[model samples]
Target: MPFYRFDHAPDPVEKAGFSPEEVPRAITAIGADLVAGMGLKEMGVHFHRKAQLIFTLRGIVRCEADDGVWIVPPRCAVWIPGGMPHSAALSGAVEIYCLFVDPDAAPALPAGCCTVAVSPLLEQLLRHAAHMPVMYDEDGPDGRIATVLLDQLARAPVEQLNFPMPQDPRLRRIAAALMADPADRATIEAWGKRMAAAPRTLTRALTRETGLSFGRWRQQLHILIALQRLDQGAAVQSVAQELGYESAGAFVTMFRKALGKPPARYLAERRRQDGNGAD
Candidate 1:
């Protein structure tokens, strides 16, 4: 697909006798308040001419890029490097924020796509920037805010929300099948038998390509799927059963071990961070 650049913010300086080019728009932002089933359900695979940061304060967005899937939960954002092909899926009620930055604006920021932790400070800055004029005074307060935002972005911590997909056709097929049917409780040997490969060969290929063992890789996918389902209001028991867990308690235990908290508390904390609820 052809690369596209979007200008969501328009410079009004030309009307004031000042050339629009005189202002340096290193960064620009767009915000939206979308209700359930009201906005884009998916952005088909495409590439952008500018680096992009997408986050939501009260909903979830699933992004696919860099041969991996990323979950953009509350208090987190997904960074897509310039010219990278990616797509996004959005649903439910969402208060989404997006930043389009000149690729050269921050050399220190991550060069690859990642899920980055969004600090409260950065979140507030994003909200502020989203409201500023497109061509605010470059030597004034707005300029300073843009500079600080870039600094904050460079310092943002990367989160472990990425579900890497292997490049091998066989492994890719397996990944797709698992995602399509996450409830499948098949063993390596069974999966291998279907692929016409030995269990050991399948395991080795997965580890070599994704830097994760077969079990770990599948678990990562499960965690990503579980987070999205839970965020969408699926009951814990329902989510566990959907994922083929024998019991809700088993699912909770696995979730706690993977994410450092149980499912309810985890989602609650995210809601609290988004100012939707109290601790």
Candidate 2:
């Protein structure tokens, strides 16, 4: 419910005099206080530019950053690069834990935000780091956990779930319409008519702006919608119908072709991996 802001980097290093060993302890205290009054479901948006790793203990959270959008479900956390603008929206009540690390220590991490799967070992490590004093010795359990968290972060895999936007106004309008009704199933001619552009011109615009033909763009839109529904826990049959697929089988094929996995399997894997650490 309450949003707290921490700007550690701005404070003078000598006056603040916080030792690197105490980082985990400070992180733990912050995590405990954040969860004290609110469960996962009650957590609100908390944004910071400082490099940090956020792990979800339960529930899901949506994060939007400069690089792209991510769905952070339980056991998953998002690694945000220093200076990247990012924000979080709770998907449901969840126990969200975090570790703010010095960017210099994690050189293998991406320079931008990315979602990472958190292993069970990493989860416990984070919990341990949450309580260690801000100035504790680096040889302690807190320090070891910090070292492991950084290692897990380096080995984390990034998943892509972003749909790039077209900048051209003509293509943008058509894209907007498709997003508004993913089940429209309109041909290029029909969409061109609605947009007051010649079908040929519309096709060229789409190709130029998105590097995809009209049909491909529409298919991608459908896939995007299907993924959104799946993330929200919709059944494959229902999602297929909602997206105007002729049958669940057709939707499965499309999902498989686009993402290399069936809808159910993809969603299940996402849930399982996300519970471990996904963004």
Candidate 3:
């Protein structure tokens, strides 16, 4: 089904206890969904009234928003401000929880879309909040729970996981090819030959539009893609090879330079912080 319009998408939140005056704002995580690959129904962009925080429980989920394409792995989520058009892409099986908030009541969210790191406290809180009703009491346990959750969300650290896409058609060509095959090792000159624009024009457009050199932009792309592959339980060596690295050592160097740690160590540290690993 082609649901390009905002009205096409179903409303899952209002059905609960949500209303105009009872509780001006609320949070819910009960209706989580799991999927394998790009499901067409939710693939297209959808617009809704309330703000959203899409968290990944397992595997990786890729999404395109107003700012750019975000690489959402486990332990992280994308904050979509209310009334924005966004679309998602899937590569494999992924588990997810979507948290919808009222901007008026919860004004702590970023004014624009961005990726946020999920701390252990926030992770468990969202999991627990999923069971409560939509319009839980405002002065009881549920209310207190909601208040704490909101505070945590506002304090959650935002991550630099979004890969901004270039708007120029020329750069788009190169960008699309790289995304389709991250292993593509062709030079800009080589790619420009097939594109309508000249190599120099494409290079300049990339730098001007994205404020990043051609090489730097591709490296950023690789890292975002790397995060996705790594989240799928892929071995570091296997991912390096698949991404066209000359050697595992070289790939690790790049990963460390960009993310401040090697793949295994970084993930392990994240797990430890999330209290999923041994203390």
Best by lDDT: 1
- lDDT (C-alpha) at residue 206 in model 2: 71
Query: Least accurate stretch of 10 residues (summed lDDT) in model 3?
Result: 1-10
Query: Candidate 3: what lDDT?
Result: 0.74
Off by over 4 Å in 3: 1-24, 33-41, 277-279
Q: Backbone clashes per model, in order?
A: 0, 14, 0
lDDT order, best first, reads 1, 3, 2
Report every candidate's CA lDDT.
Answer: 0.81, 0.63, 0.74
| TM-score to true structure, per model | 0.85, 0.64, 0.85
lDDT, candidate 3, 31-147, per-residue tens: 345466555334788766778788876666788887478878667899988889899865556666667787676876798898899988887777666656556787989889988
lDDT of 1 by residue, 154-184 (tens): 9988988888988888888998898889999
Clashes of 2: 14
lDDT of 2 by residue, 1-279 (tens): 222222233435423444333344323223522333344443334444347776666455556565344556333577777666667655444566667766567766787676676676676667666555556577877667667767876786675443335666777676667666778888889877888889998888677765778877777667756765677667889988888889999989988998799977777876675466433
Candidate 2 achieves a global lDDT of 0.63
